[model samples]
Target: MDISKYNFYVGTSRGTLLFNSDKPNNIQSAKSEEISEVTSLNFGRNENELLIGYDNGCVNIFDIIERKYIKTPELQGEGRVVGIGYVNKSIVIGKHDGIINVWNGKRNNYFDTHLDEKGTLDTLVCNENRHGVIGTGGEFNDLKLWDIETQQCIFKAKSLGHDMLNLPIPTSVRGITFFPEDNYLSVCATKEGHVLLYDDRAQRRPVVKFLEKKASYTTIACAYRERQCLAGTTRGYMQVMDMKAGKCLRTFTNFTGSITSIVCDPLEPYVITTCLDRHLRIHNLETKELLHKVYMKQNLTKVLVKSIVKDEPVEDTSEKEKVDEEYEEIFENMETVVSSKKLKKQKRHDEDVTDKPRRKKKKKLKQAEG
Candidate 1:
């Protein structure tokens, strides 16, 4: 696997882990700033900066190159920072107690929207195309989208009213994501193994629903292909669901434990996931193959990836290698021909090859005696 093109940072159970794909073994832990468990994290305004959200309700920025904290921003909320997303020039923070705060690193507070303190806000994500748009969801609460600039709820999911037994279906949303291609299209995964896709421009309810029976999907992300999504379950498996066909396409297995977060490359065909099993792994979405993995001491909660998109075409040498290998078998059993071409040229001077030099010496001696 060519891991040189990717760059990312992992937020562990204790602190942040500075990771490099080029040298996966050369890892550095950031234990400064007196911060506790890094609950959530995302990239700041640029690739050189990273935004960190701690369990103690503290938010700070760190320089990736300097390997130090730039500044810490005091939060007005009072809960574990469960989720974070950077949009526009500010960051949208979601606390465990269901408080959504948008801060621009200034003194004044932008807006503090409440999302049902009864349930824990487990997931939050921002759209890649829109700056002000962000999505949030949690236990017992359906998904909702907010516009930070306007400070209004632009969209709220309609609950799946009741089950066959007449009990209200629980909406324990564990993961949420926005599509990179179409910002209006979004998806979320729930504890009940239900993955729902919502098109805000179409309706308030889920336009499509996929069920991964008997598995608790912990995190969700966009897949390698369009009209498809990837999700990680508590059963130690990652599912690739075709949102367009409404069925699971493939299941990636071999995870040690429940996955904490899943990140898919937008421009590449690779996916990375953080697991409670204390390992960071990258997988190929097309082949469902494990490309690379690195072990860490703590459970990984979040990962911020840096993708370098290129326009050049990649050459495939698989067919060429196969052909060369087939031709090699013909010569492997053959005898060693040491002088195939070199001895053929010597055949032309066979008669006078060595005697011509002796004959010239004899003529010189005769001329000197005469």
Candidate 2:
């Protein structure tokens, strides 16, 4: 639909493609240094810089304005980076070994710590309204909010027991995001195919737990202005969940594999999703319509939906029309001129043949009579 306010960048196994949401087929590709698969991506506060983490445990910073790689920060862990967030002048990275590393531009050895050794960090996000609040969760990690200033976890989701089956439900979070308008509120996708909403002010329990899909949910994204969210499953199904009602409003089933990432457009009624099927699809949030789809050759693991670049040039329809008109006029003139020249040459050849025949006949008749 109307995606003039945002640019979409998809991270695939081979490389990344930067393009407009309106024209996803037309793309500008950028690859990682070693061509490693991009595992996570996050943009800075101003949206001027992008941070990319690869499967090889290497991170690269890119200047969006220049559309070039700026630098690669030294990461301590030797595993895939699953999550990335921004805080003031530094960035926080969540690795597969459950290690959270913070790095600024100046130093290599800045802030590093492990949350857990058993499970990987599957989701990471920051509260833009609250500077120090950061959320991280994964398998057996539950959901925890960290205070970046104090470097401590402020809130954590508790475990719950099953009722009739006596089965234990471990809080394995697949994705996390804070409501853009409220820093106190955050949401996460669970391994049980449900969405959980948390309030920092009331940490007693989750305010609501909405079941989105039948399969495990691998990613979740909060809408720009509404209390609605988008959730993707391991089965490639996408669901639109309403946090206020704690129910699923709609479902989209077109992906052939697990959904890797989801992002909502801030200014438009659209959502972008990247799937392990090597395809990216943009959908209309309100109308429940498929807007644009692109088939990437590589398996996509993540995507960074960037803000719009201001003052972009609009399409010049007038120039295209003028060129088309000039081409048609030149073609018509050339066709008429060629036809006229052929006719004139034919007439001259016919006259010459007639006159030559007459002259030959007269000479032969005179010879006969003499």
- The best candidate by lDDT is 1
Q: How far is candidate 2 from the true structure (C-alpha RMSD, Å)?
A: 13.8
Q: After superposing candidate 2, which stretches have Cα over 4 Å from the reference?
A: 2-5, 15-24, 108-117, 307-370
User: What lDDT does model 1 reach?
Assistant: 0.81
Cα lDDT tens digits, model 2, 1-370, are 5555567777778656354436646666676565788888888646777888777777777776677886565777758888777887778887777677777766543344455667667767777778867888888778888887788778887765564778776678888887877778889888887688988798747898876446798888888657888888888788888898798888889889999999888777788898988887888888878888877777888887766566878989999999999999989888444588898999999999889989999999999999
Deviation in Å, model 1, residue 310 alpha carbon? 10
Which residue pairs in candidate 1 collide?
none
lDDT of 2: 0.78
Backbone clash total for model 1 is: 0
- Rate residue 251 of model 2 by lDDT: 86
Model 1: lDDT of residue 137 = 85
Error of 2 at 233 (Å): 0.7
